[model samples]
Target chain A: MKDPMIDIRNLSVTFNRGRKPVKAVNGVSLSVNSGEVVALLGESGSGKSVTMRSLLRLHPKGTSIEGSMRVAGNDVTELSARELADYRGATVSMVFQEPRLALDPVYTLGQQIEEAIMRHENVSRREAALRALGLFEKVRIPSPERRLMNYPHEMSGGMLQRSMIAMAIACNPKVLLADEPTTALDATVQIQILLLIRELQKEYGLSVIFVTHDIGVAAEVADRIAVMYAGRIVEEGKVADVIQNPKHPYTRGLLGARVELAHGRDRLITIPGAPPDLAALPPGCAFAPRCAEAAAQCITDVPRLTAIDDTASVACVRYA
Target chain B: MINLVGEPSPILPVGERGGPAQPLISVRGLLKHFPVKGSGFLKPKKVVHAVDGVDFDILKGETLGVVGESGCGKSTTARLLMQLITPDRGEILFDGESAGETLPLSEYRRQVQMVFQDSYASLNPRLTIEESIAFAPRVHGVPAAKAIARAHDLLHRVGLEPVRFAGRYPHELSGGQRQRVNIARALALEPRLVILDEAVSALDKSVEAQVLNLLLDLKRDFGLTYLFISHDLNVVRFMCERVMVMYLGKVAEIGERDAIFEKTRHPYSSALLASMPKMNPGERTLEPPLSGDPPNPIDPPAGCRFHTRCSFAEDVCRQTLPPLSRISGAQSAACLMAMTNSGHSRAPVQMEA
Candidate 1:
């Protein structure tokens, strides 16, 4: 394959809190080909969101990142503060979980998108506004001309989200990192947003790293799926392969736990146990405590990602 | 002008013989519209149709699931049933009797209780689980010792370790454990009907299952009736014997769990079912989502409120409001097409194909 659009190798993120340190992302390596959508799938506190956020260096000031993290062929760790500023919203853009909060409350939707374009691209205010309007139309925000004048609160949640997407794509970035962009949206609106994202990804040849806790969403949109658990990716494969024939116990549990509306009247299955505290992670595999198939070795040595098949990798002793 | 009521009355009906077979709560045409006044001095008044024209019956010892998106008025309906808000129109009957007026609802209050969505802030941080659970009973004049004993029994019923959790404050418990305490507290008054408003929505998947299972078990053991309101379709399908789909503050569809899931007649209901994210990648076909949010509730569409988003809408759909009509033996929907299909052939065949 032509050099992957984004490559992350052995990426680790640690947050220091007084004497205690939280390893939020542990040795995660991911790659996304041009125009492909990769999903970071896991439940809350599973470190999926943190792993993707670390790609942008969006974590708090206390965070310390290690390993080779490159996006669009640029070494992210080597970028100076000034370069990092230009990199964000220019080379790689993000769509946050809550669009209402992500947007400036005082500014109109059009103004925000225009601001994003002008900040990254040296353009006149008129040109930026025109570009913002064009982006809004591309994202299917109806009556883009009128909506441009509406404040974040004036527009509905779905419209605001589309506006956010419009801003993200205004720079024509190579990589789009969406962190649970549709989590706060209703189901019907979520469908529209996902479709829009997929369309934009193909149209712009953009590599998308979509993060979400909902496995169903990942199944729908992801070309490749990475199942994270307790700061590490336990399984990675094509969405079809990983969802249908998942190798890791955590992935299986997650799939089984979803209540398929199509499964009319079947008893719902669910996993047991809350996620482990990041500050006090277990010594062995992070999911070992919750894994139904965990063996003696699982509680001692942490499992590394091993090839389960040509298309899949599983970090589990059973698969190994 | 509306009459200022003495107090908000419980929706539970009165005078019906308490029995295992009779439904615990029945609501009809429940409406609660808040007047929206503009910020300016000369602002015109508008009504926010928060909960408009809702009706459902919760059977004794059965869970009735209410599913809808945000702003669909599911929570508002729950609050109305609990008599936390006075309805602008309609009647609520508990058991066999109308819970007459606001003041008279005091007698009906003990029979109904509610569990809110946020378990974190629902319980008093300063009060221990024992005290939280005992608050209701003690206020109703139950002896202190008796209420404490009852609270302990309720704690055990909700699967909480009485000794460990009894004296612990709300902040001391985990999310799941704290929710269990909330459930125990709601049951402290020995209510026959419990309204759970998004009770498990905020919980993680695993913890949600534990609480849901606990709810099912409690329903069986205590012979309780539940009006379970939630936005998660998965949770609703699992917990409810019958499901009610709401849209724009109206009942879109209602039927047995299997019936609604298998044969949803309403366009809005079908869109909602289609919009849900599927775990099976093979099932991820390009189904279109509903185009936009429901028309502003303040000025809902004239005919079918859903006509604005309905892909198969007809001319009549925009001009004439469809009434709740029978779709099949057990299913009911407010759709003109379903009602026009009087012949069995049209109804069944159209649904199948």
Candidate 2:
């Protein structure tokens, strides 16, 4: 196979390394080819968002990152300060969960998109504005011309999200990183945003990494899913296989715990205990304490992610 | 038509619990209109009809799910039921007694408690887990020692050990743990009805499952009723025996869980169900089930609040307010299309330009 559009190997990110370090992402390796969509699926503090944000090196100054990240064959972590600026939107762009926070409140939607375009390419203000308008239309925003003048607060949550998506793709980045883009929108609007992302990805042949805590949303959009727990990828495989026949205990627990899957059951089968704290995770497997199938080995040995078949891999004592 | 004024005879016979067939909580013509800003001088005052004419009944020991998008007044309805805010024009009957009239406000409040979405915000930061849970019971005249003991037991029931967690402040606990403590506090007063306003929405999926199960178990043990309000259709379906679908502060549909999910009668409810992201990849919806956000509630569409977005909306739907008509046993919908059985006859309205 050709080189993946976005590639990361042995990626690890730690915040506030001196006093009390938080290991946000640990030894996560993933790749997405052109036009492919890989969903980083996990609950809060599971490192899905952290790992995706690493592609653009968006962490604070004191944070330490140890990883090899490549997007469109450009080394991400190795990029110089000057090169990093260009690398951010030209090679990859991100859509944040809260558009209100991500967007500049004072700036109109058109201004933000135009600024994003102008930053990447040598273009006149007029040209950038035209590109921004085109992007608005492409993302299916109603009355693109009128919407461009509306400030971020003027637009609804769904509209702001679409504007965010429109900005992310303004430069036509090789890879799109959507970090729970639809989480803040309503259910009906969430579906619209999800379908819009999928449609835009296919239309532009863009490789996308969509991060979400929702299994249903992941199932709907992702071609492959990488399930994160604590700070590691516990399970990774095709959406259908991983969801239908999960190998990892955590993945199985997530599926079993889904309220949608609990339609006929009297009681939902829940994974006992809470997620391990990222600041001070437990020894051995992070999920062992909550796993019903945990054995003695799971408590003592940190299992490595091993391929169970051609399409799937699981990090568990059972698979290891 | 059901009388909106002084209590009429019970709609159904006394239920199995030997109570008058009257529901534990019956809401009628509930309306809350908040005056909008910038309406004093040149412009006529406009009122945001936050909870416009919403009516429903919560039978004893039953979970009545309220599902709608943000601004659809699900939270307002919960707030109204909790008496956090009084309705402008409507009546809430608790156990066949008018909430604030026949039933004293304090008495009604004692029997009804609310759990909000943000657990941390709802909890008092100054109080420990035990103190937070015990405070309510103490206010209700329970002895301090007994309330403390009850708090401990309640904490344990919610899967939080009192020995380790009782002394911890709200800030020290995890999101899920704080939520459990919130639930424990809600139950501390021994309330018969608990209104969970997006209670489990802020937790992780796994944690949400645990809390949901705990809620169900508590319901069975305490014979409690729940008004579960959430935007998550799946969680609502799982938790609620009867579901109410709201749109623009109005009841679009209300029915048994199966009727609402399997044999939906309202266009809005069907759209809501269809909008749920398919769990199966093969069955992924090609197009968005519905387009656009709900229209502003300040000046909702002339007749049916949902007519602007309803695919089957007609000229009549725009001018005539459709009453909630019985679709089947214990299932009803407020839609002209449903009443006329012409849901599939007309093509869906074209997407707004």
Candidate 3:
């Protein structure tokens, strides 16, 4: 295989919360290829967002990140403050969950878009404005020419989201990091936004790290899926391989838990217990208590991702 | 025509005691428009048509699921049903009486409960779960001890250990547990109609299922009526007997859950259904997701609001608004193509613009 666009090796992000440190992400290694969309699928506290944020060194001040985190050819972990600043939006643009919050309240939508463009490129205000409007047009923002001057609050949630996407793609970044980009949007809008992102990805040949709690959204856009559980990727494989024939018990539980539109479908199957607390993670498998198929070995040892088939890898003693 | 007034209350099945002869809640031509300043004083115009002409029946003891894309007015409709916001036009008949005239909306409030989407904000941080649950009953004249005992029973019914959770504040409980308290509080009044607006949308999948199952069993044992509103079609399918699909402040399609799911007639409904991710791999249809965002509800298209994005849109669709024409068996859709044998059929009106 050709060299991946982004490579993450043994990356760990630990948070110093007073007395003891909390490992939000632990020894996670993942990669994204050119033009591929990789999804981080897990529940709210799964550390997917932390891992993705670590790519750009976007974590809070107290969070300590270590190991090789590279995007394109640059070692993201080794970047100086000034170098990282230049590379931030230019190399990797992030689209957050809430568009309104992501956007500046004071600046007009047009000004924000221009700021994004001009951040990575030295251009006159006029040229940046034209480029911003053009990017807005690509994002399917209606009447991009006129709506550019509108405030973030003036725009509808859908339009604001599109504007965020427009801003993210402004620098022509090699990779896009979307942290639950559509979670706050409605279902139809969510679908439209995901489709828009997919189109932009194809058009730009950008590697995308789409983080979401929704497996459905992951299935829609991701070429590959990584099922994260308590700061680890327990299963990683092609979207079809993982979704169709899930090897991990956690993955199966997630699949079973999804309610389907089909009538007379059995009551949704639930994995017992809540997601583990990141601060006090269990000795072995974090999901063992909730895993219906958990074995005696699951508690004794932490399973590493082993190849189940040609295209699939799962971290489960049962699979091993 | 079934006179919704005389028809069995959508919340209650026929032959059940205390079940309304008509739907527990009958919303007819409900329209909610929020006035907004558009540009200037002379032309201070524009109405955000939040819930535009929505009509649905919530049967007693049955779950009526409302599914819509965001800003489609599912939440707005729930608010209107709760009478949290008064309708600009149309009538909300609760238990066969005009909600505004027959009883003080507050009295009806006891009989009509609501579970909000956000569990954290739903409960008062300062108040314990016991207090939150008892707040309504006490105001409605139930004695404190009686209300507390009742709240405890309700909590137990919702599967939360009442003794442990009773004294805990909303912040102390997990997302799922707080939601259970919300459910328990909503059921405290034994309301004939309970409107759960995206009640479990924020929950993890397992937690969502647990809550959904709890709701199902609650409906069975308590003979409770539910207006389960959500953006998720799968959850809607699991909980509801009948489903109503809304788009841009209008009811796109309403039908029995099976009929709507299996044979979706409306193009918008089809598009929404097509976009949902299916768990069964065998059922996957390799269609690239829906293309465009819904047209602005404020300036909804001349004829059908959805025609702009509808694959089967015809000349008549652009020219004349489609009526909620009956299809088969208690199902109807506001789509010209779904109403007609063919889009090419010559009619009094042409579908093309």
Candidate RMSDs in Å, in order, are: 6.8, 5.9, 5.1
Q: Clashing residue pairs, candidate 1?
A: B12-B94, B13-B93, B13-B94, B14-B97
Q: What DockQ does predicted model 2 obtain?
A: 0.82
Better of 1 and 3 by DockQ: 1
Give lDDT tens digits, candidate 1, residues B241-285.
889998888888888888887888887888888888877777774
Tell me the spans in candidate 3 whose CA falls farther than 4 Å from its real position.
A18-20, B1-21, B37-41, B104-106, B278-291, B338-353
Residue A24 C-alpha lDDT in model 3: 88
Task: Output the number of the lDDT-best candidate.
Answer: 2
CAPRI class of candidate 3: acceptable
Q: Write the per-residue lDDT of candidate 3 for residues B195-292, one digit (tens) a residue.
A: 99989988988788888878887877777788888888877888888999988898989999888988987878877877775544344435434665
lDDT of 3 by residue, A150-203 (tens): 999888787898999898888889999999998887666777787788888998
- Most DockQ-accurate candidate: 2
Model 2, TM vs. native: 0.94
lDDT of 2 by residue, A85-147 (tens): 998888899999999999999989899888988888999999999999898889888899999
Error of 2 at B40 (Å): 2.5
True contacts kept of each: 0.58, 0.87, 0.48
Candidate 2 local lDDT, B1-353, one digit each (tens): 86679777455322233384669998999999899989957888898989988788998879999999999999999898999987898899888888888779887888899999999999999999999999988988999999999999999998888999999999999998999999999888778899999999988998888889989999998878899998998898888999999988889999999999999988899999999988889999898878998788888899888878877777877788888888789799988777654333442343456
Look at candidate 3 and tell me the lDDT of residue B260: 91
